[model samples]
Target: MSDSEKKALSGLTLDQLVEFATESGLPAFRGKQLHSWIYAKYARTFDEMTDLSLEVRELLKSKATIQLLKLAHLEVSRDGTRKYLFELPDGKFVESVLMSFDDRPSLSACVSSQVGCAVGCTFCATGFLGFKRNLSPQEIVDQVMSVQRESGQRISNIVYMGQGEPLLNVDNVVHSIRTLMASVGIGARHITVSTSGIIAGIRALSREGLQITLALSLHAPDDATRDVIVPINKKFSVAELIDATHEYYEATGRRITVEYVLLAGVTDSPEQARELAELVRNLHCNVNLIPYNPTRAEDGVVTYARPSLDAQHRFRKIAESTGKTVTIRLERGTDINAACGQLHNSYVAGP
Candidate 1:
């Protein structure tokens, strides 16, 4: 087979690999062995599978390729956070972030689901780039492996919260989740798939029967405000989103996470906090209050700023008073522009 006709082995699940092996005139158990090499061992090339017979390896070399992302650029923050830009084979770029903290299981890998996002949330940097394409399952899985290799640390948590919306590319996201669990050995509870209120995607994920957590980027307390901040809310209203999230919790019995980005004067008001509490009070969820990360405005002005410390404190106080759990996610990787809503493919455009 020609190089252009070769298949990628990095993304396939055990079952899929088994099917491929059988079609290649090999035993089904050979598929499991291949899975161990590609996923568990993070083998970069086909030649690294020393356990397989040389004949079988030679056959695979002709028909298959263990493709991985080409690391284009890497930036490390003084605070120990690292951001990576991967060059896709097609020449598009995607971003991933590795965050370090002082606690056990501290390293978290924030992986992108698409090359660019279509959702177009006004506050996000990726949204401005428009939609390019959905990343393959292997591309999503490779981000975690790449981060692990670069950092030399096991990523305790994986967040589908980087360049694009995970639910927008649900199939690949779900496959990546399964691979992360079955191959990478990360617990389902540690993996999070975040969306900006994609109701259909949320409904579909509930039927997945996986134990991975779901995080809704509910940045606003009301539909009127949310519609402007997260444009997806205009299509799926906050009421509908809340109902769908409730159904997901009922089906999966997992507490969901609601992410609220604190944009200085917009979403960080005490009134907004109270409204947010009332909005999600009935649901089985916790809210992560994230301070906004600076990005270039539509007018080319750098305007969005993190809320003041006092404003954040007041907002948290009001939300906590409503008898719901809330957490203030400390800003990390800000210096390297790797914080929430700040990641942009610099190779394509400037901030």
Candidate 2:
């Protein structure tokens, strides 16, 4: 167990925390106070609980302690985008990115829930890295706070599209979302969960009545090509994904975001664009077209040729012509590899 987890003798569940506090010569309400401190205050240490009495604080020191993930390294791009690499308790590392624009309205923090990914998207670096264990809710939440601590701006929004397929770690992802939304300042609508089409988990989130936006990583227009790109498409096809997405919108009354990453001469064709327009014909969603970031390949190969500017404009026109609102996502940190599909360098090892 991690030192933090070991020090965290209090409890993991909410009810357990309250019970533990009551046993330490404190009232039941002490549990609520503790929750507010750990979550609302984002305390790094039990000593930071300034509202509690000295004696009560001592009791916590004996039984429990606050735990936080420590910073490992950071990469700052020339364009202001920054990528952070954090070392977990198990020696497995995960990354988070800060995408900031000079004139942008809100900041986006891409948070990872697992050490590596299992989705295996052909165009994504994270997927090529072998799967690792899932992150605890605290570890996931700490990434956002670490970013906040450095920038002094409350993370306006969060995207679970960093290193792992969030649906695989649904419990911790949901737990982190609940704590983040309860941050008193951040609203549920601002925290978005991006997934590689994990249908059951998507449906489950919808039933919870959360207003958090669901961004589906729709990298391909059809199942044939999608299966080659997003391996998860083998299990949950586009039809099934749309079915679940419809349920999500029906339950939450919020539109989902379709994150379409355009790869040159791969899935960005007029035929594909026309097919995609038909795919979301009846759904309530917008498409965000991200360009593929180049990286070295696992076998020392680099076949990924970045798309030309004219090709991108042509693709955008196709998307716009289909009547679905489309926006071409700009690369944030080309120098530091802060763009999407650029988060993994050491592990992916290839383009």
For this target, which candidate reaches the highest TM-score against the unseen true structure?
A: 1
Identify the candidate with maximal lDDT: 1
Q: lDDT values of the candidates?
A: 0.84, 0.77
Runs with alpha carbons beyond 4 Å of true place in candidate 2? 1-20, 23-65, 298-303, 339-351
Q: Which pairs clash in model 2? A: 295-351, 296-350, 296-351, 297-350, 297-351
State in Å the error of residue 150, model 2: 3.9
Tens digit of per-residue lDDT, candidate 2, span 1-351: 435555452214456567877877789888888877765566667787898889888777877756455566677888777788776666767888888878877888989988768888876666666687899987887788777655556578788878888888998888888867765246888888998899999987887788889999988878898898888899999999989999899999999899887788887888888888888878899989887777656532234667788887788787777578989887778787664445456534433
Candidate 1: residue 349 lDDT (0-100): 64
The digit string of per-residue lDDT tens for model 1 on 122-211 reads 777788778999999888988888777666677878999988889989998998998888888889899999999899999999999888
* TM-score of every model versus the real structure: 0.90, 0.86
lDDT of 2 at 106: 84
Under the 3 Å rule for N, CA and C atoms, how many clashes does model 1 have? Answer: 0
